[model samples]
Structure formats: C-alpha cells, structure tokens
Target: MKLVNLYPQKNIEFFTPDTSTKLKLPVVTNGISAGFPSPADDFLDSSINLNKALIRNKDATFYGRVKGDSMIDAGLSDGDLLIIDKSLEPKNGKIAVCFIDGEFTVKRIKIEKDVIWLIAENIKYKPIKVTIDNDFTIWGIVTYIIKSV
Candidate 1:
C-alpha cells in the first residue's frame, strides 16, 4: 500500500513565558520557514503548500521516526521514518501506529473475537494485549516505510 501525509495544516507558534517579567516571548516555528516571518512576531499565520511539503497521492500518510528495534524483523529499524495513514481502516495482521497511555507505538495489529493484540515483529519484544481497563487508541495504519540512505 502507498503512504499518506497526515500532518496538521494549522500553523503552531511556540512561545516562552517569562515569570519574572510576566511577558511572553516567541520562541520558534516548528514548521519550515518559507522565507517569510521571523520567530519574534506576535502573530503569524501562514499557509504551506501541502502538495509540496508532503508526498501527495491517493493514500493518506504521515511521517514518524521509529524509536526502537521492535519492528526490526519487518525491515523497520531504529530511527526510520514511517508513513502512516489514518484514513485507512486497520484489519487483521496489519502494521499500525497505536496510542496507549498517551504514548505512541508501532506494532502489528492482531484482531480476535474478544481480544486485540499488538504484536511486534522482533522476538525481543513481547505482544501487548488490549484489555477493557486500558486506554487504547489505534492512531493510524502504516502504509509505507521511509528510511534514510
């Protein structure tokens, strides 16, 4: 399957609060600058060319950097960038990026009648079972793998 871009279209500005002076200072822009405003502005609203900023196609995708070796057997190594698509419905035996307890994790999803299992491709990691008590959310389905050359 192809990858999809899911980055938010809104522009986010970072600022630091000065407790001593009770003033707020603009810090930086998380997005790439298009030779426009500096980071010290009070208000900045700019639009990005989504088609140019991301790989546009029929599939929906977002970029994420891999953190561990849990998916090494699937050719996904540490520090690899993954393109995830939230629009696609996840099915049995699909690799998905899931959110559990406010943290993000990538794993192969296994659906049973009454059980949902998050399986890692590598043997070093153990599978996580989603129970009724745990807060679980499947963030997106992985569509493509992007890595640094």
Candidate 2:
C-alpha cells in the first residue's frame, strides 16, 4: 500500500493575504510555564493573533514544511512548519532555506573568515562549503518552526 503524507509534501510556499484559514486564539496574560506551578490568570485577558505574532513582514514571509531529519539537533524535524522571511538578513548562526544546484535545502548559515558553509545539525549530513562552482541563494531566514503534535 502506498503511504500518504499526513503533512503537506510541497516546499514551504509564500502566504497570500487572502488565505482562507485564519484563526485568532486567546493569549494568556502570563506566559505558559515549563517549571513550577503558577496561579491561573483570568481568561480572555489578551489575544495572540498568529498572523501578527508569527509573520513580522507579511509580504516577505512564507511557509514550508520540513521534509527530513537532517536538522534534528537544531530542533527541526520532519513535518514541522517552517516560517521563513525573505526580508530578514541571513546572518551567521541563523537557519535558512537555501537553493543550491537547482535544489532547495535547509541548513544553518555559517560564515568563517572568507568562506560560507551550510552546516547541518545532524552529524550524518556533512556541511557544504559554498564555492564558485555551485549555484546558491539564501532564499530566506527561518524565523519560527511550528511543531506538529
């Protein structure tokens, strides 16, 4: 039997302003905790609009679903929704979606002296050094990763 992907199989694409899905959820006044117990705050005190919170630049922001485990150590996994923004500068240590040799791959940007390297979080995948022979473009900077439960 052929297996179906529960997550979308397409490259993270740009978000249009007229997307049919828009959810506005309530945001607690206090941040959710991972440590000791805290008192519960009143409900509906504030709201967290994902579009506003997640997309800093709506026009340049896009979405792509991660396809592999090459970046597991960086907290990236298969099926995670990656939020990328073209407007953001690709700085050192920032994760980016890159286009190389006509293919798209996601990796962390590393600039060492005069060289550029696409470093993978997983050891199995070797870091690729950018050279004159390769086609490369820092498509966008990853701002957030939405993990699926």
Candidate 3:
C-alpha cells in the first residue's frame, strides 16, 4: 500500500480538538470459515498477516470515505479514504478530520489568535469560523491519503 501526499505544495494549518474525553471504539474481528477443507491454510495465514502489516502502524488512524467536493482543490476527492490519527497533535498547517456539530468533515484548520477556522479548498464552499456556541470537535489529524485510481 502506497501513501500519497495529497497536499504537497500547499501550506495548510492543523488543529487538535480537546481529547480529554475518552473515545470508545468497537473491536472488529475477521471471521474465518470452519467448513473450508482446502490445503490453502498457509496461503490464508500469509494473507491475513499481510493485511495486519498494512494496518499495523496505522491502527491509530481511522478510515472514513469522503463524500463531497469541498476538499477537491486540495486533492481530496469524493470517495477517497482518509487516514486520520487522533493521537497526533494538530499544528499550524495540516489537513485534519474534524467533527463539528455532530457532523464529520475533512478540512484544513487555521488557528488565529482569537479564533479557529475550518477552511475549504474549493471556491464554491465557504470557510467556517469556530464560534463559542458551535459544537466543534477536531477528531484527528490526517496523516495519509489513499485514493482509488
């Protein structure tokens, strides 16, 4: 699996949401069929191991399928998988996956002296400034981008 740099030439700001609250993630297990009587046990084991390796260092990153063109100018298109890491601290300029007012969105974070803003790369979309009353939450920092060709 190759990781692509989505925003290579652009300088984007990053932000971290207050993660003092605990997050509960559900555990998922890959189920195996017991009725298969093939001699491909070795192959199956190897495949599983490979899958694990591809995602081992990436356990901290959550996968979310993108749904809009707001980030297209930044090279993030619709249906792309975003690798977001919540443990990474948000900085001045980086792409991040944020949850605001019960909705999840991928945007570039900008931190001003007195305000935080969520910026969209597309001209058709408007930038969102964080307000005191808004339910804003920065879910994670986007570390890698995976797109389908």
Candidate 4:
C-alpha cells in the first residue's frame, strides 16, 4: 500500500493500510482480568494476524495518526492510531475523519435535516456546523482506535 502525507498541518497523518503483511501473533483465549491475576496456562491457544483482524476492507482501509484532543472524551487522544474504512457508511453518531474547507478533522457526526454537525467530544471544543458553502467530505468512518498506555 502506498502511503501519502496528507494534511500534516491539520494534525492528521494519513497512511494506506498494508494488508499484505501477515504477521501472526499469539492470542490469549481467556480474557484478562482487570482486578485480579489468573492462571496463564492454556491462554495462548490461538494466533491472530493483526492485518487481517484490523483491516476489514484492504483497498478502502487507511491509517491516521491523531494529533489533537478534540475527541479525547471518546478515548481518541493525540498520537493514537485510527483505523478508518472508506467503504463504511457514515451514519449519525459515528466517529469519522472528515475534510472540511481543506482541513482534516476527526469527530462524531450529527446529521440534521439539511446540515451536518461535527461534534467534538471535549466540552471545551465547540461543535462545527457544516454548510453548503464550505467544502466538506466524510473521508472515512473510524473503525478502531489503537492507543498507547
């Protein structure tokens, strides 16, 4: 997959998903407990390929490194990796990566009768209302978010 530097000034770095790399990693069959520790035997029963597991549509999938805190309340933080699928339908309440007036932003979509609203999860950030005069496009629907602890 070809990677492109799209809208660096907009705080989003875009890259095409490399579905060709199939790296199988051991997966724990039993769920990990948050409160207590458990036995480790029989946990690694199977393997998983992250490329296959994450990329639902290889041709339409893209990765974007987030660079802002607009969606911090939604668990998307700066430096978080976002898996976006262009083939997915952009419905109301879905988190999406959008291009508006030549800038890229990730926000929850709110579909009104005649207008689209980009709602930020942070209370400090105000929602952006998209109008017909502005150039807008729902680039892709955010499917998964990979974050570092």
Candidate 5:
C-alpha cells in the first residue's frame, strides 16, 4: 500500500501460481485481420492451456494488475492484467515493472548514454530519470497484457 501511495499511479501486483487450478481454452490458429472481416474457420480450433501459452519459466513468471492509464498508448490500460517475467533482461524500449525507493511502477525502459529513464506513454505523465538518489531495480519484463472488454 505504501508503494502504491508513493507512485500515485502504476500500482502493480505480483502473481503466485495456483497449482490447484487448470484452465484450457480453445484457440484459433489463423490470425484475424483487423482491416477486414473473415469467416470463422471451425476446422482450425486447438486447445490451449493458458499456463503453457503464457508462461515460460514458472519460477520467474508473475502477474500484475495495472492501476492507471499512464501506459495507455502502449496498450496497457487501468485494470489490465500484466504477465511479467523476471528472468528476461530489461532492454531499451521494453516495458518493465520497476521498484524505485520502495515504490512499484510500470514504465517503458529508455536507455540514454548515461541515464536510464522510465517513460510513460501518456503525455500527461513525465518520464522518470533514475538518479543516484533513487533506489531502483527492474522487477520484471512485461510479456503480455490482458485487458477487459
């Protein structure tokens, strides 16, 4: 809660696996076209376990619920479920869930020559430049985002 207060926006959560639950859903193999409508292919249905589709390293993967629109342009809206992987290295232009001075934040990684900036996609929020005064660590790399319709 303290971390959420400090960040004001970007309240992120860490997910733990629930081994008791197993869910398998049907997936269509063909990619849907955004520009045109196409007939549904009933013959192209395959079962997909979410855990197998979304997760790579079970020990390093976690989920976080986003709480703000700072990343709306990046397609991460408030209340979106984020799949985070701690094993992935944080690279420039990758979205990352970061911990700074005991606060949690989700932002895009911007690597300058000598500075690292945590950038927000929305114009209302400014990029955060990491300095020696701040305590920062990249918690994880965001792999997928699930938004509610």
Candidate 6:
C-alpha cells in the first residue's frame, strides 16, 4: 500500500470541468447485470455529454480528487474523483468538502442545533466537532463520485 502524492500540500486536488468543449460518449441505456454476464450489444443506445450530465451549476462545480481513505466507508475511496457543487445549500447528513483550520477535508455533515460535526466514514478516524474557535467552512457538497474499476 504505497501512496502517490498527486497534490503535495492538499488532501483533495481541485479542478474545474471545461464546459467549452463537449465530449459526447456512447451510453448503454440497459443496465449491466452483476450476478451474471450479459450478452454484449454492438449498438449504443445514445450519446451523452459528461459536462452537461454531471454539472448542474457550471460556475460552482468543481472536480476534487480524493487523497486519503478517511471516507472510504462512505464509498469515497482514495484516488476517487468527486463532483462538488458549491452552490448547494449545506444540510445535515450531507457529505461535504470542508475547509478547516487552513486545510481541506471531505466529511459527512452533522448539524446538532448549535454545534456542527465533521464525521469520518472510516472508524479509524474520529469525528471532528467544529466550534466557533475554528476557521471552518463547508466549501461544497459532494454530488457525485467517479471511481475506476
């Protein structure tokens, strides 16, 4: 288990989707079965533009690459690409990309009346209780996750 430093100083590497160029990819309308192998279809059902499909707010959307396994149990693994929308309102139980104490971290939001908690999906890490003393902000909400098989 070796780690590659994609961004030397950041836990999440951020990038904005280039909407100027639309790349349409063939889409399979039918669902692929996991239990058994299905016959391959030669014809594509339709084509989809990833930029249009994934991004709802082009101005506020950003792609963040996961750097650690803090949220692995939440299905956000290391090296996974996350679609973040800054315009979305922050709410309880929503997974968010947060900037805390000069560093960025992705965690599940836990709003408790006056207090807020940044929870890690993996048990190895502990839940962070955010107080007024800390410089924290919910940068964006994680809308989608892109994983490589």
Better of 2 and 6 by lDDT: 6
Q: What is the TM-score of candidate 5?
A: 0.85
Off by over 4 Å in 6: 1-9, 37-42
Clashing pairs in 4: none
CA RMSD for every model? 14.4, 5.0, 13.3, 1.8, 4.5, 4.3
Best-performing candidate as measured by lDDT: 4
Best by TM-score: 4
If ranked by TM-score, best first, what sequence of candidates would result? Answer: 4, 6, 5, 2, 3, 1
Off by over 4 Å in 5: 1-10
- Estimate candidate 5's RMSD in Å: 4.5
Report lDDT per candidate: 0.68, 0.79, 0.67, 0.90, 0.83, 0.89
My TM-score estimates for the predictions, one after another, are 0.61, 0.85, 0.62, 0.92, 0.85, 0.89
Residues 104-127 of candidate 3: C-alpha lDDT, one tens digit per residue: 788999988988899999999999
lDDT of 4 by residue, 16-117 (tens): 876777789999878777888988876688999998888889889889998889999999999999999999999999999999998889999999899999
Those runs of model 1 whose alpha carbons end farther than 4 Å from true positions after fitting are 1-60
- Among residues 3 or more apart in sequence or in different chains, the pairs in candidate 3 whose N, CA or C atoms overlap within 3 Å are 12-93, 12-94, 13-92, 13-93, 13-94, 14-92, 14-93, 14-94
**Worst 10 contiguous positions by lDDT, candidate 6:** 1-10
> Per-residue lDDT for 39-91 in model 2, tens only?
77764577666877787887687777788889999999988878889899989
lDDT of 5 by residue, 1-149 (tens): 11122223445666665433568787778867688888887656777888777888877877788888999999999889888899999899999999999889899999889899999999999999999899999999999998899
lDDT of 4 at 4: 73
For model 3, the local distance difference test gives 0.67
State the lDDT of candidate 1 residue by residue for 1-149, as single tens digits: 22333333312111111122323333334654779865744454454443333344323445676877999999888878766667778899999988776567889999999989999999999999999888899877876776777
